[model samples]
Target: MSGEWLAEVVQTLQGLGLNYAFVLNPGERGAFIRGMGVTLQLCLLTVPCSLLAGVVLAALLTSGRPWLERPARALVEVTRNTPTLVQLYCAFLVVNMLITQRFQLHGQTNPLTPFVWVVVVVSLHKGVFHAEALRAGIEAVPRTTLEAARSLGFSRRQLLLQVELPLALRFALPSLVNNLVDLVKMTAVASAIAVGDVTYESIMIWSQRDNVLELLLLILLWFGLLTWGVSVLGRRLEAHLRMPGYGQ
Candidate 1:
């Protein structure tokens, strides 16, 4: 019964003149699925790593020491203002070129491949945005809360760690989720460097099959599902973390 339904669906799609049979073919199916795995790997690695980077940046920005804040602020501003793709290209083409020159490895094309470049570049870019959002959340932390923590002899570090960051994260959850959604979409750019993500795989198949519309539709649906899952998860987390009195 299941096989019959699956066949019918495939037939209906084929009837529309789609070359989606690529999905049914073993070798092509493997490539496309591998592309999806690469995309998923990017999202999984980047989301948490970027969040961690954001926390570090936010701490530096709010630490009240110009020595620390100035440099961190400059980094954040530069990352936020630039295009991620350009950054990816520079890191891959320019920096990777330098690395290759310095270390002449026989069988390697630099330790940093397109995957590493995408992860680092995307994480830093999204991290700056996350930091700015968290800074706002940190500022919105109640003055009374700070005073209470200080009255209890909490050191500045302790206050930030125990009091401010927790509340700030709660405040910034929505923005963080939105950034994550954007970051997932941003992973598509990995294809530009031949990382062979889902987008890249789709391009390969369509270029060969000349079924651009079919592949394009699949790409959109693929990304749409990923972003939708992220959105749902974020909303659920926001609800679970809702403070009793803060919103009220």
Candidate 2:
């Protein structure tokens, strides 16, 4: 297509308030959709991994063993304190570079692709928040309840797995949901390391088309729906898991 004609078409689309025309263009649409897919995949993978890591970290922090507890606490502190972008940079540029050099794989891609790096960094970053939230929940469990479980011959593992974790999860549900919502939004940072998530794709699109506002609006709407859905789910879980005669 001629440059003038392309410009006219884009202008017409914008005039009609179809600022999102790029999303409808077959060529551009594919890129946008692919980016959206990557973002979703990152979220799907990060959520579960981060949650599991958070639980483990929280367990270790409360384990009463100085060796395990100190290291876990330090990890949580460092990750939570540092900027996520810096962490991603270090992971991609430093850590991945070392791995690439140490193991020469001709014609084979590195096992830790950009996708894996993003997942690892984002998970650990948010895992700290999850750990903190869960730690509070664990502490919130009534001492009386723990004593009763102990009196009933519950082993430490049994008490934690059956009694403490369940109740703590219920207590922590709201904060956990908030952290998850933030985690979904934080996936946008993956674009920094060239992970090709929605934010990255949008940047590439707007650079050529100059439709920054329109594309950003779409990004905002997409993330809004995602975070809102998470909030709704959290509320439902909170309601369902609420203890009888206890405030939700």
Best model per TM-score: 1
| C-alpha positional error of residue 38 in candidate 2 after TM-score superposition, expressed in Å | 1.0
Identify the runs in model 1 with alpha carbons over 4 angstroms from their true place: 1-8, 105-109
lDDT of 2: 0.89
lDDT of 2 by residue, 115-227 (tens): 99999999999998998998999999999999999999999789878988898898888889999999999999999988888999999999988889888988998899888
User: Which lDDT tens digits does candidate 1 get at residues 1-248?
Assistant: 76566567778989987667676666777898899899999999999989999999999999999999999999998888889988889889999888988767565556777898899999999999999999999999999999999999999999999999999999999999999999999999999899989999988888887878987887888889999999999999999999998777
Query: Least accurate stretch of 10 residues (summed lDDT) in model 1?
Result: 102-111
lDDT of 1 at 186: 94
lDDT of each candidate versus the true structure: 0.91, 0.89
